[model samples]
Target: MCYLYNVESQNTKGPGHSRSLEVPPVRVLLFILATFLGFVLLELWLYWQSKDKPLQLGLWDLIFWGLLIFWSVRVEVRLPLNAGMSQLFLFALALVVLTPPWVAPLAAFLAQWGGSAWYKEFFNRSQDGLATAIAALVWILAQENPLYLGRWDLSDGVGIAAAAFSFFAVNSSLVAFVIHLDSQTPLREIWRRNMGWVALSYILLSPLALLLARAYETPLLGGWGGWTVLFFLIPLYYSRFYWDEKVRLEEAFDTTLELLMNALEAKDPMTRLHSERVADIARDLARKVKDGDEAYAQAIYRAARLHDIGKIAIPEAVLLKPGTLTPEEFALIQSHTTKGAELLSPARKVAFDQLVYNVILHHHERWDGRGYPKRLAGHEIPEEARIVGLADAYEAMTAGRPYRKAKTPEEALREVQELSGHQFDPRLVEAFTELWEQNPIWRDRHAYLAAKEGSVSRSTSPQRSSASASPSPSEPGPRTSEE
Candidate 1:
């Protein structure tokens, strides 16, 4: 009983408190080591696949990376200084100067100078550079924190996790920003493509850094090295996806524009065959003038297809009249050029807007200053548009209409050559004649039309249908070589 009493006194807290604690640091270290090895192997495999080609860095690329890094470091260093609005003013000024040198100079200048003017003129009358400076200061302060030290801490397990997350955040942000700026791609698209890279890099590199930190007891090595690897990986990942998407989207846009042109042909049944013939002739002429110039070929095709879109506004009575139009009717018909310009203006917001808009607006302008609308002449008419105009005239003259008999191929060519300087661009006419002479199909179509003079039906006149009419010769009766 006495021994029991003594033992109870020793355990005065009312319990047997004699348990040993196990830290298990070695087990944690081993786990981290294993994770690091796995990640290294995966990264090696990915790098081997992607590193087949040599890295050719451009001047602009170097400039952009240098500026980004500089800005990042500056933010890191000045965060704790409490420099207020002055710091922000300096940052904005630096951006204004540096951005133009890397991005488009004209775009940067307009955004900087014109944007400031617009803001002052419209939104805030009293706001000045100081106000902008203050706003920038607020933004910098929000992003800065002393504990961050421009790097993540990975001494403890929690710190390792934090470091991994930060690596992803920083690298992903940089990649997305660069892609958006360089490719002129949408922000959402950049994010969609780059997010996977961020994830993969984190999965592969974070564990390795954590293991190295634990093994070496130098946490900075793992944290900093992991971030560097992520930085390089981000751009690599984006390059693969960006180029793939760019090519696909470009091809899709080209196809869509071509289909739209074809639709324009379908709108007018009578003009469908004529448009095709003109497009062929115009394309040939364009090749002669500017051989292998894709821009010229595309412009010719677009202009020829839309040359008669203005005719949509013309009345059926005037379009299909068996005889010549009255002075007022002819004037109304001439208004098609302006109407076409108006119709195509809305579509100018698309990808090849400038080229398409030029064709739609200026195809009717003649070599001389006597053309309608703007009366632009010679080189001002646009070379491709001039080619289309010439081809259109040649096709219209050779193709019989209800009002007039089709001319012989020789007569049409002679007429086109005669009115070269007055009605069309002389150089374009010369190119067109050369192309027409070389193509036998064109010669045969014209010969066939010339022989079937007065063969087109004037009974079912254009005044009957407000919509387009079909130009099939066999629908009513078979057409002979001569009517």
Candidate 2:
């Protein structure tokens, strides 16, 4: 199986769908038990069938391929989010192709014995072993006997391809499902975002396993295919470099965006962790509103975080004004929406998605069509913008400016409810109400900060931790801070 493991990071770009990747301990344990038990049952059944009719099994071949797979398992390449990929599947699948149904999965189970924590290692071994068992069954169904140079024809190639595809499908689904359970991300979305490209690679590279099996069968290379198998190392080593560069580039992009966010916060201290709080709320609401579209949920999350990017360009004088703003000053403040959109436009093709641009430009727009910039109202405003707008208002109301007293959580909830149809999508307001009832840490600023502090001190899952932490949101600052 092509194993994927989560690597925790602050950036939300990769596969770790949410800030907290916690799953119900019971569910995870049940899944591991089920998977491991299923593999054992299959192995026992396969062994029973083999006993009835003796089949050629190569112990030396098993040792050689198991060691190769172990080596591959040790060198995993990181992917975005908490996921990773490695060449473990290549040799493991090759072992499935060349050996009997019972042998390869056992070898795979043993090969994955001690890499990660005990629970993680057990889960990996179980899933990989189960996937190998299923793929080995597919190979047996396609071609009754193991492949040799004599049997290596076009039809056998089709069987190998089918087996390879089955392996990928089973393996990725198992991993994706676990991630889905852990992060509450949609299962289909997980596969679409993470496993789509890897599927193609599985099919394209399956031929190499066939060649390996054939090489072992051939007398031209002396003993087994061990000598030629060594050649796979060069290409595998180089492939790691490719994935490394890709991950580096992604990290660089994330870092650059963070720097921009940092600069925005420095210019407007009021919005320090304000964006992160709003983003957390927006993402939660987005999942409720657009549960089927993972991309939209993720986009709204990103857009909420940068919704105030335009505020960076606003003059500090007007931004810091304590008294009611003059018409001209208010206008200047509103133009931050357009300015932010323009500033981010250059990166649209490269980094920012259209939904992100929409939220940055239109987050302040009111549902009643009275808001600024485009003044797009109702459904005319992008749904992404509407979601962010509602979240931003809630966050800003609770995280009051230095000149204004911050509203209590109950007061903020009432205000949000009162403004429902007039300032927010009624459906979204309903969704937010439900989320509020759930009492997510972000629903209350004080609780959010407490949880953050606790998470830092106790190393717990700080689901509500924003992009950055600072003094309390309600505390006064150097200037009159406005949302």
Candidate 3:
């Protein structure tokens, strides 16, 4: 998998890229602006083209649009890819099969425009209008007039399927285009990541669109397909409610983990920000490793932040000791891993996976056969553990410790590079180095602090010497020169 770090796109910067709704880039705004004008032009052209058509618009089609407007405006289920899922599609098909191809998309645009304006969402009105116009235009290309075939059969159903799919495809493409412009995410990535399952949803739901078109088109059904949708509509509204509850539940889990982290932080005042920095590094590393999403990286980050929760079981005397730990005290401190895992044991009842527990328990393990608790060797430790372990070491080195003052970020990175294949995963070290180079905060912290303190700048070069007895970071290893 090609990670963004290796892609060399200056805009594909690392983790702390905030997406909190500030004013978007001018380019994104301009793109949306251009789309809105295109939609207006398309609507006018479609109107002019349909003005002289032999076919006349029907009352049932307008009724179907009203039903669509009511059901669609009531609820929208959020998705990772596009904005939301709603039931405007059922009528979109009705327009293609029973009325002019342009009607559904145009009606949907008008309904959405009115609704969004009432809700004071001027921006969404623009998005709705453009997206609908695209869907309408594509549907028109597929069907010059409504399919007037009588006595439905497999071939007839296939035409319905094809027409509906075309509209959905064009609609999704428009939405994806805007998302690409707004997020600066790669267009291909957005389609693969966000639109893959969306296509599936459209496929699965196309039959309902077909059914609605059939019910309304056949005079025997009395145009009650609009009311028939109530069955699915009720469940869809409830689904949105259920999804909201699930979101709250996920937030509650995060808050509980944060509380545990806070309790652990109470034991070591100096290391309060330690877990957060490690989480930041671990998140970036996880994203590089899997080509995973920002959300997945954040999950790793949340898990990393809780890696030290077991330390809450340790007494302050050993945990906060001003000097190096004695053998027994160190062993006791090490037991916090097992203790931390035990503390989190009950969370399994609620479906918490072993990944977080593995990270907490084995983050201290080494790449070589020499680590604590289980004494596991390379690849024996969980991948999450190896990642958090490296992040912990870097943070521990850069962060001032009870035993010694903090090393510069440069020294910490050198220590990380040297430990690869000895204490840390060599691959993860390489990944970390890639991320570290991208984010400036990791390198700038110490220098800015020194400047503010009016102290002479300490050399951040890798040649610094420390002779601590601990096997960690004191003696640089053979692979120190690799990168």
TM-score of each: 0.43, 0.74, 0.74
Worst 10 residues of 3 by lDDT: 1-10
For every model in order, what is the number of clashing pairs?
Answer: 0, 4, 0
Best by lDDT: 2
- Model 3 off-target regions past 4 Å? 1-29, 54-64, 77-85, 93-96, 113-120, 141-203, 219-223, 292-299, 440-483
Candidate 2, 50-113: lDDT as tens digits: 6564445567766778888787777777665446677777787777666667888888789764
Q: Which candidate do you rate higher for lDDT, 2 or 3? A: 2
lDDT of 1 at 390: 76
Residue 60 of model 3, lDDT score? 64
Model 2, runs deviating above 4 Å: 4-38, 52-60, 79-83, 112-115, 118-123, 144-242, 437-439, 455-483
C-alpha root-mean-square deviation, each candidate: 25.5, 8.5, 8.2
What would the per-residue lDDT of candidate 1 be over residues 137-214, giving only the tens digit for each residue? 322233343234358632333433443444345334433443343345555545443353235544343444334323
Model 1 CA lDDT for position 130: 21
- Candidate 3 C-alpha lDDT tens digits along 169-245: 65566566766765666676566544553466566666766666665545443455545655455765664476546
